[model samples]
Target: SNRFSYSMNLKGASMTIDTACSSSLVCTHVSKLHLRYKDNEIMPASVVNGLNLMLFPGPFVGCCAAGMLSHEGRCFTFNSTADGYARGELCGALLFKAKQFNPADGGLCCLAGSQTNQDGRSASLTAPNGPAQEKCIAAVLKEVGLTPTEVDCIECHGTGTSLGDP
Candidate 1:
């Protein structure tokens, strides 16, 4: 973000977020807040960017040693056959703007409402709680004045691991 700001001469907020796999998704939620409530008059559009780079073999070697990597080199998320998660490199970005100022062309999705939560109590630190996630999704739908039936599709992020199995 800092590099992009320097090169593009953009003077917006430049920060990094690290919430493991949910880093990019959290950025979308933060973007909505920034756009909906711009404290400054000069607030411009927000660009949420996520990057995953494998610069060295340390992480790969570690996950491999811990048996947290899929032998097939592919993710089998949510499947009983899932052995472990797959790792890859990617760089992506999304630009967000208020609807009124947003151009009609090349628009992706609207930012209505977004929410975030964590599993306070769990079997393990990394173990996922299905009910907690369901509640969070339901709350977001309610905030946006929509119901589960009304929503056609939803995007999800999965680590593709069988509970980060050992």
Candidate 2:
């Protein structure tokens, strides 16, 4: 399909990520790694796209059965009323380049570093593990040479599920 082949035309290594919720961030981490180790001249840039179209009713029904959808139809992230998440369609894309290429010319900022980890042996495959989440955050902060106190802002995937929300 054109959607998949379009990236191949760029003449650089390309791959897809299917990790629900963390797919985009994970892809960014991989791009950063390629820029760090691969020849910048050959693969000077990487493009990451995340597209979600939730018009279908199949997944929605599953989420409802699992109690992962907001009964009130809202995402009360970090709030006392936090229940479940409201699903919606989202489309976003980001371009990354090696530091030497000065990607700032095209974008306001560049990725300093990134890290990824998995929740091995969790209670359930769908359940979020707190210890694994903690480890992932600590690892990324260490990779970027920053402490928890030094960071002011953090973007999180607020799934809005009772068990998933912190």
Q: Which predicted model would earn the best TM-score?
A: 1
Q: Residue-wise lDDT of candidate 2 within 3-50, one digit each (tens)? A: 555745766776778888788888888888988899999988888888
C-alpha-based local distance difference test score of model 2:
0.80
Steric clash pairs (candidate 1): none
lDDT of 1 at 60: 92
Tens digit of per-residue lDDT, candidate 1, span 21-133: 89998988888788778854566578899999999999999999988888988888867778888889999988887545444667766777788999898888888888888
Q: lDDT (0-100) at residue 40 of candidate 2?
A: 91
- Candidate 1 Cα outliers beyond 4 Å, as residue runs: 101-105, 164-166
TM-score of each: 0.89, 0.87
Name the best candidate (by lDDT): 1
The lDDT for every candidate, in the order shown, is: 0.82, 0.80
Q: Weakest 10 consecutive residues, lDDT, candidate 2?
A: 1-10
lDDT of 1: 0.82
Error of 2 at 133 (Å): 1.7
